[model samples]
Structures are given as C-alpha cells and as structure tokens.
Target: MSSDKKVRQATATVTELILETFRLNGRLIEAGDELVRPLELTSARWQVLGAMDRSAVPLPVASIARNMGLSRQAVQRLAKELEKGGLVRFAKNPHHERARLVTMTEKGRAAFAAAMAKQAPWAEALAEGLSPDLLSEALAVLRALRVKLEGHDG
Candidate 1:
C-alpha cells in the first residue's frame, strides 16, 4: 500500500479502537450492575470486594484505587459501604503511617465465590468460540498500547 493509504488505515484503526472502548465500557458497567444485583452491591462496590479478594495482603485504599483504576475517594466511599455491609474490614497498614489496609472478610469471600459460581457459565458461553491465543495477544497489545498512550517507557 502507498504511505498515504497506510497512514489513513492507522488513523482509522485508532478511531475504531477508541469508539469500541467506549462501547464496551458501557456494556461492562451494565453487566457488572446486573451481576452484582443479587448480592446487593453496586458495580463499584463489587469491584472493591474483588480487589480485596485478589490482594495477597491487606492493601491500603490508595493501593486498591490504583489497582482498580478508580479514584481513591470513590473507592473509599464504596469501601465504607462495604465495610458497613460487613464484607470488608480495615486494619492499619504497616507500611503507611496514616493509611488503613482493607481486607476481605469471610462474608466478602463467600459473596465473591457465590457470584463467580453463578457467573462462570455465562462467561464460558461468552468465550465459547474465542481462541486462547487470540485473547492473550489482545491483552498484550492493549497493555502495550495503554503504556505508550500514558507516555510510559513501553
């Protein structure tokens, strides 16, 4: 292809990627909302629970925010609700003088386990025709692109 044609194709690809990201984000939000409804949690709150479940050790609210790609204040608020629900508990972080660590409570673990059990079949069906290789490549490419977009030394 000519240089001009290549440039146009690249631009179009980027544009499509951006638009599809927005579209998929909406779907994900909706799916999350629906997924957590029976658990009586919002999508954000559910995500906080999931973050706590994934942490090797109790993580500070800031750390969870960074991991979950959410604002600290937002996660903190959701954490507060989760705390009230007896799903997560706060402990003092050894590394941070002022930050409290958040960890999943047994209730939180049960909730996550139950939710995943219900969701597994749906997820499997969604991926029924997808190849593992393609998924891995997509993840790698997206991660690299995100790093480059962030002005990181990717």
Candidate 2:
C-alpha cells in the first residue's frame, strides 16, 4: 500500500479511539461521582482536591486548570465552592499578588483519602483482566495525545 493510504488508515483509527475516549471519560466521571458521594464530594470537587493533594505546596487556580485540562475560570469557581465547604483554602501567593494559591484543608485531605480508599477496589475490579503492561502502554499513548492536543491549544 502507498504511504498516503497508510497514513489515512492510521488517522481513521486514531479518530475512532479519540471518540471512544470521550465516551469513556463521561462514564468514568459518573463513576467517580458515585465513589466520592460518601464524602459529600462531586467528581468536579474531587478532581480539584486530588490536584492539590498531589501537589507539595499550594498552586494557583490557573496551574490547577492547566494540569487538569480544564478552564481557569471553571477551576476558580470550583475552588470558591471548595473553600465554602471547608475542603480547601486560599493563601497569598508570594510570587503573584493577584493570583492566590489554593491548598487543600484537613477536611479536603480526609475526603480525598476516603475517595482514594473507594477508588482502590473500583480500579482493581476494572483492571481484573487488563495487564499492567497493557495499561502502561495505553497511558503512554494517551499522554502523547494529550501533549499533541495541548500543543495545538495555542
């Protein structure tokens, strides 16, 4: 086959995979929402908490949004709600006067921990037949796609 034909076939396969990924993302969010319900957390709130929990120090809302592939305004709104619920707090950013940093509170940490506990079993069940190697390979592919998407965002 010609190189052009091969490229077209690869593009079509990737397009189908991307569409399926979107469907899977929606389902995963729904499942995550259920998993964090015990902590009175929605998937959106849990996402913000998880981001902060993973960070060693506080992060600006824009940083969090970029890390999570979300809009800065959306993250700011969620941060406000999280703060009102005592799950997170904002502190002055020494580097930036206007952009305060967001940090998870003790309550947020507890909720995140609870959610993680629930996640362990859920993930294990979902990975029952999937090989670790296969998952890692899939992750690499997805990461490459994410990088490509971000590159085009500008």
lDDT (tens digit, per residue) of candidate 1 on 35-148: 878988776777888887788888999999988878999999998888999998899777888899988889988988877776788688878999999988888877877878
Q: What is the lDDT of residue 142 in candidate 1?
A: 79
lDDT of 1 at 153: 59
How do the residues 67-146 of candidate 2 rate in per-residue lDDT, one tens digit apiece? 89899999999999999999989999999999999988898888889998999999999999999999999999898888
Please give the clash total of every predicted structure, in order: 0, 0
Q: How much lDDT does candidate 1 score?
A: 0.85
- Top-lDDT structure, candidate number: 2
- The TM-score of predicted model 1 comes to 0.88
> What is the Å distance of residue 75 in model 1 from its true position?
1.0
Identify the runs in model 1 with alpha carbons over 4 angstroms from their true place.
none
